[model samples]
Target: MELIQEVMIMYCTRNVTEDLVWVGGNDRRLSLFEGVYKVPYGVSYNSYLLLDEKTVLLDTVDKAVGGIFFENIEHTLNGRPLDYLIVNHMEPDHCAMIEDLTRRHPETVIVTNAKVAGMIKQFFNFDIDSKLKLVSEGDELSTGKHNLTFIMAPMVHWPEVMVTYDKTDRIPFSADAFGCFGAINGALFADEVDFYRDYFDEARRYYTNIVGKYGAQVQALLKKASAVEISMICPLHGFVWRRDFADYIAAYDKWSRYEPEKQGVVIAYGSIYGNTENAAEILACRLNELGIRTKMFDVSVVPASEIVAATFEYSHVVFASATYNGGIFVKMEDLLHDLAAHNFQNRTVALIENGTWAAMTAKQTAELLGKCKNLNILEQKVTIKSSVKQAQNEDIDALAKTIAGTF
Candidate 1:
């Protein structure tokens, strides 16, 4: 059947090549691109209906869209009644409709792991008494024609998270794996979208912003996923992956490893005035002249989240800032504080500071570097005399050398 492109509606239809029904959401939030926190492409709250002899519903969307989600559920079930609802991730965005679902289909069993059950109780405050079926790692539950193998993915962003694999369908119900933040109108498979150019960036942005802190755990999950025979990935967000599934896995693999996108130097400056920005631009030019690709961000203009995300994607990060009241700008401090908390890994950092009398940024910025894990700090520091000088040309040259050598 043909799919329609309408906004803010949840509907259901069977995958042309698979037995699973796409239900739940493909709604877009208009406010999703208003600012730094807004993920421009929005997101999809995906759920699935897999029918054999027994039926399984993968996940649900937010309570705000619970009505539409249930509408999709009703349309797909056609009064046969759902047998199971698989709670992949316990995050409210995907699990908010669980309560309503349970109330609607009182006989439907909730399938999840021990940790997830705890979260369900904690989040919903319901004594689900006897309605829970707990599965652990490598555990398989059979429903006649199809078998679901549960793989525990702790800290693939959350502790209670697990992925469901239907071996018969060769599909992995990847709770949050291979997910992006866009709402698809009519598309089902990822290959239907321009994933190479657009979706990949959204996926990376999602990973860096949400799951970057759990890089090690993601790597472990990726390893586990690699061992499975998966032809499709039905994540809780964005498009479903049927064809080119390996590419998404490979993309996640690279992201978890903190691999650089390209040989580029990111010159991030926290400028109090135009002074520090001037230094950054000059340094970028020098790096460019030396055949080194450079991307510059004014920490004031670009968000701290974006900076951290880009920093993880670059081999070299150079921070330029003006000292204010004997310290680096509050914004810069906040950025450094966040970077430290996330254990900013796998990058070389260089510092540039400008201050009239106190000149505290160089030392303070360098001190902030100590908070990050696996961070390599270049030995040379660029100190400005409240302004740029001809002698400062050597500092840019030195910065270029540091980046070239590290990359």
Candidate 2:
């Protein structure tokens, strides 16, 4: 005789508004997000279901959570025919289940822009023209009492990205904007958790690593969004913002302009031996003793993403490295390039170099950092030979004093 084993479900979803429900799901099983950033608390893929006069889904979750997502949708619908499937950002994580959703809801009309329509055709092999309903910026779709206005968000992280404004509810379904990295846990809203204490770091990391390069684009999107009165924000990831969310919007505005959140020093050091790190430690100690906030990391130990995230939040930065073959150390070099590639700029910087023979790291680092935008590199640099010598302690002190003086 054949035996059947009962299937277990692993999913958590919530409701956003009176008629709108959050039918998204989480992926605690995903260790790495985008196969690069480390997601310790995992990540959440958000999608919304609108129980209007006509049923609609804002977006779809990642394929990893598609099963639970579909089940949630099925339960929420309760046999109501899905009328519209709105496509915002066409990233694979958001669009992975596009074909699957269409197959399940055959009567559903796919609503998107012309560029996204092409992308849909590129991503799936279906007769899209028959089900496609193309829209543009300022276009509105009325579903019962709700009127959603589309706002184009080009390269806020993607060219095809767009946000929807629910004028009826004063909610903006922001696509990838104001998004963070972490599963929503059991809570669905930002006010439900101590966001700053528990999730702020991950949010910074997510913004810096993924969307850091396109600050200009983000600024444009923000300017456009300012014209609309946003009461609540529904991003495609992490927590929803319904209450006490002004600070969150302010954060996006500041970050998009490449402004630091607070006045603190982030010291990232690269050392083959312990000498360079020792020098870095001495400087950090002096800064702390001077009543300045400081965060220190070894480039070899901490991943570049974390360091970059910290640097993005702080007003000042310090780089210490031991010369490697007459150049900056490999890890340190990679980290600097990573920061530069992400358009990291607009902060005060100091440097420290250590070498037995050729001490050229500080100059090289300064030159590389100089190529970026509006960075204030200090004239004072600390130089160490083998270790933190008693005489070089004065140099460390001087650098620390200079860094503190800026604040």
Every model's TM-score: 0.92, 0.95
For each candidate, the alpha-carbon lDDT, in order, equals 0.80, 0.90
* Candidate 2 residue spans exceeding 4 A from truth: 1-12
**After best superposition, candidate 2 residue 178: deviation in angstroms?**
1.1
Question: What lDDT score goes with residue 205 in model 1?
Answer: 70
- Per-residue lDDT of 1-407 in model 2, one digit per residue for the tens? 99999875544568898899998888988878988888889898999999999888998979998998998898889889999999999998899999999899999999999889989988999889999999999999999899988999889798888888899999888888888899898799998999999998888898889898899998898898889887789999999998888787788788878899999999999999799999999989999999998999999979899999998899999999999999999999999999999998999999999999879999999999877899999989988888888889999998888888899
Candidate 1 C-alpha error for residue 369, in Å:
2.1
Residue pairs of candidate 1 with colliding backbone atoms = 42-181
Candidate 2 residue pairs in clash (backbone atoms < 3 Å): none
* Count of clashing pairs, candidate 2: 0
RMSD of each: 4.4, 2.3
